[model samples]
Target: MTTERRVLVYGANGYTGKIVSESLANRGIPHYFAGRNREKLEAALSIVAERFGSPVDAEIAVASNNPDELRPLFAKVDVVINVAGPFMQMAWPVVETALECGCHYTDTTGEQDWSRAIAEQYGQAFADKGLLLAPATSYMWSAGALAAEIVLENKGVDSLDIIYQIDRGLPSEASTKSFLRMVCNDQLYLDLNEYAAWDWDTLVDVHVPYRGASIRAFPWGGACEPIWYKDDPRVLNCKVLTAMGEHLIDGVKMAIDKFHEEALSLSQEEREAWTNTVGDTMHQGEPPKDNVTAQRSCIIVGGQGQTTTVQYVMNLSAPYTWTGEVSAEAAKQLLAGKLLKPGFQSVATAFNHRELLQTFHELGFTSAPPAPGTL
Candidate 1:
């Protein structure tokens, strides 16, 4: 990518946004910060300068929901790395503004409904403009999707079972709010190449090698993989399952069940208010700790067909840190004209899967053996 290309980190003041900004700075990518708070944006820039020993390009106070405030800056930028969360509520306007300004778009969203909506509603628009709309390029989903792509490379591998297990780390307030908003309804997955609903109350016992046995996992939001693979002609079935940790799985499941149960009687507005209330109680405005030393997570994707079976694994630590690096790398690749096609995409579909895996490998994100079809 050209060093002269401009990138804008929207929501630059948020917990994850600062990490993304740091990644961009480390890569020497030219970028600026934009957010609704002038003080927070300035503070973010100061943090970057203090950490890197050099000041960032600039910081602009712009309201994300205000198209008037966004249009000018977006029109000037080559790419927009949106770190804003609870994307279902805050992402559309930015996505619209990016397409209007002809800038590529990507975000750290794990909301399945949001991804499906973006693809169904705006996918064609982005393609028409030759721009991209890659959502959920974060660890929760994209990392596992990468593993699925690796397994798919093996011929005759049709169905996929993906799992995400996080053994440590606490949630940020924004992330907690996003989770509360999403778990209030059933999540959908691709079943035999068709949409299938996942009842929020059930859990699946699946094998996780790290655990050396089966562990209970939920189809948390069904993730973005099924959506990414829904239209691909590859073999049929896909299901995604995840768990915070064995210790917390039951509690997490109970909370989800409670939300879904209570939401049945509540109006839409009331459900939202209830979600905010519970989310605030759970997180209490705490910034998540980057405890890589204690962080133990696994993204396991396995594919089974009549005559073939394949599995790919990714052991992770501090996934939020990985999210930051992945966002910056994706923006760089897009600016370098490395995308497979425009419009709604997952990481594997949007860019070369192996190339991305290699990038992560070099950065210490992957410790597994080479994928079945790779050299």
Candidate 2:
């Protein structure tokens, strides 16, 4: 790795991509901002120039998944923070190119199946390459969950519940479309469908005193957390409750059901194509409605021996924003001679929580109880 931290942000023209660029600029880090859009990249460069006075020593490149363009991107920087996703369809090629060029790879991928795919298909190769590969270090899966791990070790926490709620901000239609495309990929939907197929009810009433009298919460996509809670049977269960309004959830459910009724007869390939077209076409706008103001963040685990029950919120709504930032930071760590050992990694896995939390805290997030947990 180069001694100086120079990064190529692969999805720099996205909604969250702008935020990543801002964070990197504010850090005084030299970055090569790139994306598939030449016009969009130019526009972002204008904004950056207006703020930071023309990058101080930065260059901009336009790139896509194509090797002719992507290969050059890899050679230009010590790392690539892939902010482009729903990563299930996109991970392998970008990761493959990065690995081939001997560059570190970091992304904000959260789909569990994708993780399984990586482990089964490429884990051994990544370890042998002695390259740092990290994934899922954002709002949904990494940071918040990592914090829960920290709080769990604090003693006296009988039952633990992490309630994640997104109250206001609407996701960009592009993100929504990508998410749908990922869902359309059959393997992505299989496990969730099978679990929901049983119509099994596996949640309980939680009274998070800090949030309110009580809120209905459930396990987050059936993720297993007992590994961290295994020592104490008293711990009961640790669940991530995606607590949003019932009306909203029910309304979305109806729309999904109607779509399914219309789509039940297509072959697998046809279904994929239709899903991509329809998803992209339907969600093509900023969808500009009321307040873009949104609340997004992971809640910490709270219970008896874990005496503190709480709720937290983050400003992030786009997955790429988190991925690009953390990945850039991880790359910088390598450049600074602070590189963590290679082989599969997450942003949190490569660094301590204190540094991560401190960086995020500066980004407008506030931890519950105000004191902030240790990294």
Candidate 3:
């Protein structure tokens, strides 16, 4: 192991990637801003320098998942925070290369299928090498898992109901692409300790504590929690539901339901091609600064056991900003030699919940006191 630890932020030119890079720069964490385009990476670095009011003294590397090209970059870095998404199409090669180079791997993926693939296929390999393979380390899944862990508190909760709500704000182009990809894929949830296909038509009404209204939410796969809590004997069921602003729910659902039907009618190859074209066209540039500054996100977890139930809520501003904060912090912990047992881990599994929550609290995130609650 190198005495001095270093990190590389791959896909540093994307909207979320730029935020992650800026977070690391603000913390004075030395990292290489890396991506396939040198020009874009340089442009992102310039913005970071200006925003942080100090030039980031970091190297810029042009590389992708091409092993011969990426191996050298991976060899020099102790950790890689991959913000690139629709991770299903992009994560495999990058992860494979990271493990081959003996570097810790983490990403901001919320895709259930891809996360499970990493855990099942490469978990053991990473464990054997004593390296961490944590995916979904950003706001989407990691924050939810953290909230679940906090509420469970080893209470032996056997079921989890997770809900995510965000105020009206623009999602990054990468996030929109990921959503497009997800719409065409089969969704899964955990039941009785086994994975089952989710019924997209089954929408449940959830009362949003932040918004103070009930919104209908469909089963959004099991997300990363089912994968994280899969083998844990203490948990037997996990379900995740997500919604945007209440006013937008019906329109978004109608669009998604329509797309899902059309996508499922085609062959796998056709679906992939169609989704890519749609994703490209739907991809908007970076969100406006004012939108990000004014938006807020929430994650609510309802944990139930044979005899007990608890609900926990977390509220944070600027989903993209929080994603950047959490990703940068995870990288910092890994670079500082914090070792996890490896094997496809969630943020909670890889790091201390209290420590992570403390960091978030310090960053202005608020958590509601746990108590008996409805929805």
Q: What shift in Å separates residue 118 of candidate 2 from its native position after superposition?
A: 2.2
Candidate 2, residues 209-283: lDDT per residue as tens digits?
346555554343333232223333445545445554343444334434544776657775566566566666556
lDDT of each: 0.81, 0.55, 0.78
- lDDT (tens digit, per residue) of candidate 3 on 1-375: 233538988888888887888888767788888899989998988988887788875689999767888889999888889988778888788999999999889999878888888888999999889888998888778888888877778465789989987777566777776766664577787889898877666567888885556877755544788888887887899888887566556654665676776776888678767777776776566776423456777788888998888777887677777888889888888877675566578878788777878877777754543333332
TM-score, predicted candidate 1 vs. hidden true structure:
0.94
Error of 1 at 253 (Å): 2.5
Worst 10 residues of 1 by lDDT: 366-375
Best by TM-score: 1
Q: Per-residue alpha-carbon lDDT of model 1 for 328-358, expressed as tens digits? A: 8998888788989888888788898888888
What RMSD does each model have against the real structure? 2.0, 5.7, 2.9
Model 1 stretches astray by more than 4 angstroms: 1-5, 288-291, 368-375
Q: Which portions of model 2 miss their true places by more than 4 Å? A: 1-5, 48-58, 152-161, 181-209, 213-239, 244-251, 263-268, 281-284, 287-298, 302-327, 339-341, 368-375
Model 3: residues with Cα > 4 Å off, grouped in runs? 1-5, 289-293, 368-375
Q: Of the pair 1 and 3, which is ahead by lDDT?
A: 1
lDDT score, residue 19, model 3?
81
